[model samples]
Target: MPEETFVIAGASLAGAKAAETLREEGFAGRVLLVGDEIERPYERPPLSKGFLLDKEARDKAHVHEADWYDKHNVELRTGTSVASIDRAAHQVTLSTREPISYDRLLLATGASPRRLEVPGSKLQGIHYLRTMADSAALKQALAHGGRRVVVAGAGWIGLETAAAARSYGNEVTVIDPEPTPLHAAMGPELGGVFADLHREHGVILRLDDGVAGFWGAGQVSAVVTSGGAEVPADVVIVGIGVRPNTRLAEEAGLDVSDGVLVDQSLRTSDPDIFAAGDVANAYNPLLGRRIRVEHWANALNGGPAAARAMLGQDVVYDRIPYFFSDQYDLGMEMSGVAAPGEYDEVVYRGDRESREFIAFWLSGGRVVAGMNVNVWDVTGDVQALIRSDRPVDPARLADPKTPLAELA
Candidate 1:
């Protein structure tokens, strides 16, 4: 009998945690984790929140200590990229022309920030927030304050970065084509709340307009909008969105849609191969549909589930979609999928005027998703309501006096 070799591509949060799980599950076989980044696996939330504000230390985002991999006998290959996977030969070829054989493989290649296609986009000072280096550079550019910071897109990334910019006393302006900030995520009902929140914090909002182009000599000095208005900017941050990285899996003859297609067990089209993290559009039993989550919690939990499945354990990846964001004095946690038009109405408990409340999205009188803003310790109860799939009285739900647990 020969010893098995397990290979994981993309040294991201998912890949790193998968390696840790394999060892903890007593897989003594050769474990190799390869990534293109020079830095070790790190969480991304801090890049837009705490770290960007310089409130969190630089070393706090790492998945494991600098020495954890070496001590655990895991082969940590940083600054190395997987160019292709030869499925026939059960091997992955590196960019450096190195080939490694693997009995089983995991692809957690994550996603990349989508860039603007407008003119002058190549100008200096136009930034995207995806990597640690990007956050560091943006922090340096805004930390001094008094700079004109123009952010394109009013999504979580854009708004959070805008808050950080304002925290430093910089003049911050956020532009988005949608009617309200977070329009796509929370819909118009709750999006209005965020719009007011940012405005109250001294962040300017330019809604219903899109960036048409940039103007500058060598670095960005201003942004021209579709509405024919020019907004001055010393630094420009683009946070539109991201696209999943599925080139490796796609080229390997695996099923690919918006992301790599996988079953409930995280198994790809090929049995010996699997995908997780932002790259895997996995079938979720709880949702009764396929969902590809780009949030940090998905990566944090998906990796371990995939590892257990690789060990021949019965695994069902049905975690409720979850994510969190912090801006200025507000902190929020959202659970379950609340895609546009999927939910009929949103019910609120607590005071919306004070910005302390739990908003529930219900369809057919059943709670599909819930978000708690400036409210703590109700995540489990919120999740339970979503998982129970029971219809509830809207009046009772709206009553703050009614405990969420009783409704569940």
Candidate 2:
């Protein structure tokens, strides 16, 4: 009998993790992991930190050692992209004109960095951090330091990249339309904490400004903002955001929203097809809504959950959405999803001024979201609080003496 075949698109963290789970779960199927990039499946978190700082090896970034794929009977296809999905025939057409059929298909296509469309964007020194190649190129340019580095966007990628560049001794300037960095995501009070952190590190914050265009003879020389002000720049990194790679899923006639729509089990409109990672706008039963998260933790956990669901296991991809960031001396872990205007109050424990605190967003006396900065070993507690959805006294919630477990 022919082996049951499983095809996974976009050999990313989610893809790799799924492949690993398939064998671990005794699937004994033919696994084909396809990717458009030339490298093997790898983790992307280190791209902005250790990899950029030259403290991480190229091999260290990979999800598995080189021999792992072959030993597990997984077919690895690098530098290949899916051209179309033939849902009717259960086959995928590749860019190379090859067609592969699958009993189960997983789309882990992920997302691409949103680009700036302004004039002079074609200039040579402009960069976007999305791939290993991008990280390597940016690291090479920032290695010498003393260069004028202008980072556009105050999102996680932008801020992390700025921290890496600054650590290399480069004079850095960060631009964003918000009055302060991370304002939209974390609110102004907590966002101010990050702004102050960057300022203390000697990084200039160009807040409440929009980029008009770029200025250069050939390579980028400066970034022109809305007020006709030009910030001299030898290199510019844009990290505005990312758009999920949902075209193939859309073409395949699956439900597509901000991302590919998946049920609570990560199953798409077609049961044989599933989506995970950044490309999946999966329903979270715990949150009572669908959310598309582009962070590492989602991919790490969602991959296995989706795989288990594919195997017909009784499971749901309901893990609390979480992500963490490291900038300079700051380490932060955030859990739970904050629906727009859902939280009525922000409760704080510890001292924000001292950069050691945990902030909780409470809605109807229940924790909706929690963030711990420069605080460790409490993410599990925060996760439990959000999961329990139990009411807690605001005073106790803000007291460092009150254990997070006790609040639940």
Candidate 3:
């Protein structure tokens, strides 16, 4: 029998893990992991938190040791991108114009940071955090601090980077059009908590304002807001959001929506193709709807599920969405979906004023999502509550004496 080949594009956390899973599953066929960046696959969470803060070393962010891929007999192609996918030929053309044929293909192309289109965006001082290189550069820029840093967007990335900047003694100003920080993700109620957190830390908040343009001579000097105010900035970090890389799947004639559309098993519209991680808009049975999760947990687990599906296993990628963030002295873990309008009421457990609490988002009296801030050992309980899809008495959920295990 001819040796089967499996090709994984992106070499991201998801793609690299898929390769490892294939070898672990005893697939003796050829495995190729291709990526555009020169560095090997690494975890992204540290880029904004520990790595950016210089609390963690550069090598700590890597998914595996440099020699792991070679020892596992996996073909690692860094600094190489998939230029196009030929579905009929079952092959992908690389940026080097080399063609690699595969029996099964996994597209974990991941995402890129969104760039500002306003004037002076191309200035030298403007930065975006997505890759290891970006983090390293930002760290170097902020390490000596004392610079006027302006962060556009109060989303996760924006706020996290803002925290890092302020920690370095830089005068940080966070500007967002939303009424509060994390308004879209955590809703107005909980978003107010973060707004207060940053405010107490001396970070200026310019809420309900949008960046009209940037003004500077070769480097950004000030951000002009739509509200007709100019805020001086020696350094600018744009963290509006990210966009998934779905070109390869779309060009291959595979289904593509907000991302590559996949089934519960992570299989794409094409039977021979699969997708996971940030680029996959997969149907999650637990959520009863398709969700394209860009969080680290999804990529960490989704890759293995896709690999098993390729191995002819009955796989259902139905894990609840999870993500964590560390800003200032606050550490938080959030499970399930809490997007705006998805939940009716936000219930708090523990002390919100002390910044140590667990907040649950409820929909129709059932726990839809839960976030534990500066709290430990309750992630499982929080997840169980969301998974049980059972209604809980709001009073019991809020009572400090009532255990979360019982409420679920």
In candidate 3, the residue pairs with backbone N, CA or C atoms under 3 Å apart (3 or more residues apart, or in different chains) clash, namely none
Per-candidate TM-scores read: 0.99, 0.98, 0.99
Error of 1 at 391 (Å): 0.4
lDDT of 3: 0.94
lDDT of each: 0.94, 0.92, 0.94
Q: Judge candidate 2 against the unseen true structure and give its global Cα lDDT, from 0 to 1.
A: 0.92
Model 1 spans > 4 angstroms off: none
Estimate, for each residue in 114-191, the C-alpha lDDT of model 3 and write its tens digit.
Answer: 888997788888999999999999998899989999999999999999999999999999999999898878788999
Report the CA-based lDDT of candidate 1 relative to the real structure.
0.94
Model 2 C-alpha lDDT per residue in residues 1-408, reported as the tens digit of each score: 888888999899999999999999999989999999999999999999889988888788999999999999989999999888998898999889999998899999999999899999999999999999999999999999999999999988999999999999999999999887876566666788899999999999999997889999999999999878899999999999999999999988999999999999999999899999999999999999999999898898888888898889987788988989999999999998654476878899999999999999889999999999999999999999999989989999999998889987
True-structure Cα RMSD, model 2: 1.1
Q: Can you give the lDDT of residue 99 in candidate 3?
A: 96
- Return the TM-score for candidate 2, rounded to 2 decimals: 0.98
Tell how far residue 142 is off in model 1, in angstroms.
0.4
Best by lDDT: 1
Model 3 Cα RMSD, 1 decimal: 0.8
